[model samples]
Target: MSSYPPSVPPQSSAQQASQPTGLRQRLADLRGPAVPPRPLDARALAALAANPGCGRRALLDGAGVDKTVLAEALGSPAPFGQSQFAIVRGNSFEAKVKSDGGAELLRLVHAHLDPGGEAPGPDARVPDLSAAGPEGRAARTALALREATAAGAWTLLDHPMLALEVAGTPAYLEPDAVVVHPDGRWTVVEIKSFPMIDGAADAAKVGAAARQAAVYVLALERTAGKLPGARAGHTVLLVCPKDFSNLPTASPVDVRRERAVTRRQLERLTRVEELAAALPAGLGFGPERTAEERAAAVAAVEAAYAPECLAACELAFHCREKARAADEVTALGRSVRGELGALTTVEGALAAAAGPGAAEDPTAAALYRAALLRAEALEPVG
Candidate 1:
């Protein structure tokens, strides 16, 4: 399978302008341009920034930015500064965590693949008994172990200790179960009530879960980073249900997959560490009036919530409170290069409107082409 996951491309402004034939279409999407984002309370901001992606949730939840201001900031066309850039970067890396088919397959292999495990027995019907909470998790663990022992191909680990922590962050692990295989290796199991989806539980949703498992793997490694007495390899297994109903069937996650995904994404984590190094930890974007010069940096954003700023904000109800006072219709504001800016600016709030793939808009996704045409008209780069 291809190692890289799929991604969506960004849209351009110029291509959007040509789409709308009517004036009203442009009036609807006026939030393309606005003042720079304000200073933020990083913690409050993640809630606003939260998406379905798990990694985005974990990392942003760690940083403490203000959601309202960040929401306002994202609506603007300006490129993000280093701090904002770092936060957005975190969202990308974290988006990769989640559980998938591989995890589900592992669970089946663990139970049925054993040497002489009993016939599905009394619990043959349950698709995932592991998600049954303490009683279920414990019972499932015991039954699975007995089957493993009979099969001879499997072995159950006892109270194996596991922990997942990065160099500077706290370990937020509460491993529900751990098992050792006949291969002398071990597996950690995380049971979930939700049905399994592709990459839904892997680093895609619980990206940190892999890192968390890595920490446990590290802990198992005991400083040398290797598990002693046990086999040379151990994996973190994520156990989840196979379907939405009360099916006893469950799935198992492979640790190696977690390791592979985390290694790539961990590179994206440095910005968080770098920014944390540069600024005081408890920085707040709003209410910085106590310091004279500091307040100037965010004055425009701090003074009022510009109508454009709140266009896509989840806090629309909050923004609507201020909509009555100002011209919310012009959220995109004047273009930066004026004409050049206009070409690349958000077209929704203009005389014409364009959305991503809005081939009907004033421009197709061809704002860059328009910009290029203009740039080409300018004197050579010499």
Candidate 2:
């Protein structure tokens, strides 16, 4: 996730009411005093959306706590780090695509997304969005978007900062680019280094990129809603490398489904203040705190762990350790946890497969039959 300087904007009456008094201070206390809160980006928000039920992640993230640092302090540091080569390659490719005032990038957008509209010409505008801070940059981006929409000309706002209110707090997001069509429609542009082979890319990487782009689309809608005759397009431009080459390729990814799912999940997330208020008093994850203290503080909240979390969450290793120590069925996987039904522990599942009352439950009966088959197979081999 990207980091930017933190800014606190004035809250409206509705926002103030939604966030209780002293909640921000309390969250600050939960994080170390004098430590800057980590600003969340689209990637973190997408991960949070993927596991909305995990209040631990929601609270930790909303509090602006640095889970990577906290994980290191707890001795279970997250194994999530991008290779330097990948980062350099991504930057180089993005620079190449956006070179010459985004001539190539605009061409791709015109070709793939808006073929019927006017083609981008040399006069296509690339707005400068520089400002004092993230808040200022966000305002600048909004102004540029509004002006671009009204002009009815092809324009690109490169790396524009957009502000999204997540659980009553503002999160600033920066997309690769935003294109304004001649018809006053805005489309998100995501530039990635992954290769699209034979008109296809890795489905997992594509899905991840689409989810991240969906977040940009959602934020764009919030800004476009206030502009007359302006709308954010559900289909976003996904630009990637073409099959083992550095040359950029474009594909249109429709993120309506992803947008809906992310929006619903974000709405379902418990407010950060409320989650903090429910915690016990005097809980802190500061560096001054001992390892045991930090562990206990983290354990105060519940976590829904699955194998998939290993990829998305910084605290997956710690949560997995806890789940395995308790023999929780969720440690196996989400599908296995669901399939086991009422058997919520590995011990319980084993007992159901070998002990009494197996006939009373469908899952248990199936497990019992499978266990008998395994025993027969082993005995015959012996």
Candidate 3:
């Protein structure tokens, strides 16, 4: 804040900047669907940066950007954009606990468990460090300095916010632990006192860490703007204790990974927009549709494919709900899809309805086929 981004000034420049270039780029994006994307926060940016492969899917989910639209944006080779996600599942939580904060003493535990949220130890051990306090300010500056020396990351002691806007917002990122891997690229590292669990970073509690790091990346990129010396990569450093009371240790995770994931997500979500665009006059995703219309849509998805739900997927709940509510067999998770009896796709229904002796099945498939046939037959021959 002291250097780059200038801290969104609580005063004058706010008017000149007109919503800070950083926020503008993030806020101005109007690509995908009828759905307005949620404003980009540090959380959203961090997510995209973390994903580089399949993590691209989360970008759409995290940003609330439609998936089909995102898929289109990505077009061919992945990672045009991205999102954040939890990488490991199996006991990463316990592993994190074992590796963080040595202060795992029961007293510390009781302090958290205790009705009154008081620190178990005297206040001296855990100081109230803030930029305003002499000790806090000194510690913060020192930590910032230490972070740069150790990481080889691009450190802006106090960068200025003069970069052009992307998506309309100024790119003012403040990087402390910008690790330029052997690849000679720039990575922004954040030192956190939190513990790491290979869990969803986008979840409410952990999302903040990623988001904060992302904002710094944005600010730094904006301020540094394509300098020949500028490194093209990005990341976040999450520092946590190996034991409850132990001093924290840090790990650098790629922000690019998250971004890659998010981009794919956006691409897929855009399909809803496509559907809306091609839909007949009044058709929509709204509940106003009659049961038949809803059933028809559901059947359409079910006919073509079944998707397997996975433990690592961020949208398990969403998939489950849609699968349950609409009988979208395709929405079922792959692991259990076969067991659950959902292997068929929408095409199967139509095929069955048009087969040599097509009247046996009375399901939605036959009805839909009949509707199409009736509509087509109704057209007078030219």
Candidate 4:
């Protein structure tokens, strides 16, 4: 999707004037007066959906605070980044796939997504989406989408920007490419460097890609909703390398399930204004703030920590440390946490299992039985 230096849609003067100054100032204060807010991408949004209960993450993201930097300040820097070599390879492959005025890309789209429809010809449109800023580019992309839908032609939007409101803030997203079919259907095209061997790729990678693409589809739907007779397709084109070669191959991945799940999770998020309003006064996440201050600020808000947060959240390491210190059972894993009903802490679960109450509580009885079995298995096996 879109790279850093986030391209949020600019609010009209009247719209800006109408906003409550108190909430906006609070968010700005949390982000720091001088620091710019990092723009949220599809990947970040998907991660947010994966762990929707983390109010800490929700507020940080909504305010556009740079979590990578914030994580570093907390001494638990996020362990994710692309290597320079991988970056070069991805860029090269993407350029090759979109070459020849995206002729190959369009051909693949037609063959895979709409084979029964008319094939894309040389006359297919690749409209100019260039504009002065992110807001302009987003508006221009929307206009192009509308025109393409009205004209009923095959079109390709390269790196077009889109905006989705999350937690009362607009998050700008950019898909690798969005293909407009001849029948006015919009399909998101994701280009990745991973190899597809024997018509299959890594399942985990594909799942992650699907979740990210689902975000793009959701944003596309918002844009298409205002246009008559326009609809965003549920299936997306996942373009990747063929085996070890740079030759491009594509698969149609259905994202209806992911879309539904993400939509529900997004809806469940607590609004940013609400989260900010709940924070104590003078709580700032600016780089100049001391580590103790930052830690205290973060701890003031409750975080639902789980192992999955390691992959999806920047502050996961810090949260994990806090959870372990407090003996919170949620740090074990979501499944484990779910299975230990009413036992929020490890000590509490252990006490329940070893105490007289074990027989009265089903969960405690099960844990007690498991503990006995474990002790028996470890009994100095001769």
TM-score of each: 0.36, 0.91, 0.35, 0.93
Q: Which residue window of length 10 is worst by lDDT in model 4?
A: 10-19
List, residue by residue over 1-382, the lDDT tens digit for candidate 4. 2222233433322222333788767776898877666767899999999988999999998777888888899998989777777887888888899999899999999999999999999988999998866667888999999999999999999889887888787777888999999898999999999899999999999999999999999999999999998999999999999998889999999999999999999999999889998999988888879988898889988799999888878899999999999999998999999999988999989987775565678888888888888888999958
Score residue 176 of candidate 4 by CA lDDT: 92
Rank the candidate models, highest TM-score first.
4, 2, 1, 3
| lDDT values for all models | 0.35, 0.86, 0.37, 0.86
Candidate 3 ranges with C-alpha deviation above 4 Å: 1-37, 42-185, 191-193, 196-225, 254-319, 334-342, 345-382
Score candidate 2 by lDDT.
0.86
Question: What TM-score quantifies how close candidate 1 is to the native fold?
Answer: 0.36
Higher-TM-score candidate among 2 and 4? Answer: 4
Overlapping backbone residue pairs in candidate 1 total 57
* Candidate number achieving the greatest TM-score relative to the actual structure: 4
What is candidate 2's lDDT per residue for 171-219, written digit by digit as tens?
8788889999989999999888888999899999889989999999999
Candidate 2 weakest ten by summed lDDT: 1-10
